[model samples]
Target: MIMDLSKQVKIALDYIQSIDVSDIDDTSEAGRIFYEKFIPMAGEEETIYKIENLEVPSFEQTINIRIYRPSNEKELPVVIYFHGGWFNAGGLESHDRPLRKLANLSGAIIISVDYRLAPEYPFPTGLNDCYNALEWIILHAKMLGIDLKRLAIAGDSAGAALATVITRRAIQNNLNKILCQLLVYPVTDASLKTPSWQEFKDGPVLNYEGAVQAWNLYLPNIKEIENPDASPLYSDELSDMPSTLMIIAEYDPLRDEAILYAEKLQKSGVAVKQLLYKGMVHGFFQMGGIIDDGNRAIEETAQFLIQNFNK
Candidate 1:
């Protein structure tokens, strides 16, 4: 379908298209400037009850995490969040606005994890950091005012990919702490050969070339692209995964893989909610400050969280 872009998305696309990324390097100063320029800042939300910054001890280094609470509700459910940026860029500050909004809207505490990025830490390092953070959160749930049984994992793009990996690991270890996963246009397959990849290869936001670049930077070798840990879509088993809410963009190169993964999860008897935003491009979920659809998606996600947490 040739869906027309929403006004805000059109503006976003215009802004993105006008950028000169010819000299940009994904690992250097140019990447930093690009991230700062493109990633929308949501500022602050008045509804948030509290915000805290703390560190979690990981295998080789200390990982920083930001906690956002909507209200003074004790033992609130928690959403562990990982930010996008193709796993090479993005950190706590870049995603702070959405985290706060999520905290307030979902009536759950939001823990934004600042996991290590790629080309430096590489594939499993960031994933390992996320898993370790999950472990720490669960172990110290009480001290953090979190309800162990009401935990959820959430992320956008590469972060969504990491969330899926963490959820899979949690199931394999027989840990039932995670109740649901909120994935926003997740990068589920590293193959980068899907039909959508061909369709949106140039991207309104994320292009196929950029996607490949990210995977190359994240994985140690090309062969690792097929590893289920690196690409959750490659996993043979999807059964027993936590309930899932997947938000996909029709114009995103990663769209098809997200749909395929959701289908797989549903067929595996996992509860799945999928939203395909027509005319939307990748990363729309984080552009709420400019895109109306972004806020709507967030509201839907918050409702999903509240419903699942109540269940």
Candidate 2:
């Protein structure tokens, strides 16, 4: 059944329709517009206890990372986050507001990793950057005032896909400090053939054609789409994945894949919690200023992280 769009979301979609985004994929035009327009109106930035910028050395390159300390508490848990842009557009600045809110709400030091984008740095580059950042954070936990034992990984959309893949890699490498994964409407499959993808093919925020474009831009070869590292849903084993909390939107093309991933995790013996927000569409989590559900999801996400941290 098709769900009606929330009133606020409908208004937001109208505003989006008014813009001339026909050239969104041209020279990162979509990113420019996102930073200039959408970001400023994303809502008030949360008051963080402290914020720090650092560069982590990773495979002959240095990846930028933003750390948000929520309080003066020592040995606090940490959440390493990756921003979503279908692995091409978003960065540290584009997602600053939501990360700050997450830091404050979760009361955990939030390390936002600015992984390299695709089309230029295609498949494996961004993923490797994220994994390297995770390793660096764990290695420098003591100096960063982070409790290695209570570490968590999180991201929205493409970033969530990275988080899941990172968790799996961590398990394989036996770097088992990760306690949980907080995925917000993640892109779990590169195939883009799910029922929700067809149902919401032209949905407000993300559409089927856009998703296909994203995958094509991120993966040089179509075969990469089935690679587990590129698509978490294709992973052979998920039994040792970290405890998970996935937030799904009813009207999102990525909805079914996210739900299916949660079910797969549960069957693999991983503790899983899934929340389906009715009448919501993709990217709602980043629209706290315009959508009430964004803030509520943040609270719920924080609670979930806290519960896992305490365990």
Q: Which ten residues in a row have the lowest lDDT in candidate 2?
A: 32-41
- All candidates: CA RMSD in angstroms? 1.9, 1.7
Any runs in candidate 1 off by more than 4 Å, and if so which?
1-3, 18-27, 41-47
What residue pairs clash in candidate 2, if any at all? none
Query: What is the C-alpha lDDT profile of model 2 across 7-124, one tens digit per residue?
Result: 8888667665666666677756665465346664468987889999999998897989999999999999999998888888888887889889888888999999999888888989
| Tens digits of lDDT, candidate 1, 1-311 | 36577778888878766767568664555664676566553434445788999999999669999999888879989999999988888898777777778888889999999999888889899999999999998889889998988989999999999999999899899766678999999988988888998887877787777777778889869888889999999987888788899999988888999999999898899999999998888877777878888888899999999999999
lDDT of 1 at 116: 92
Model 2 residue 126 CA deviation (Å) reads 0.1
Worst 10 residues of 1 by lDDT: 38-47
Top-lDDT candidate index: 2
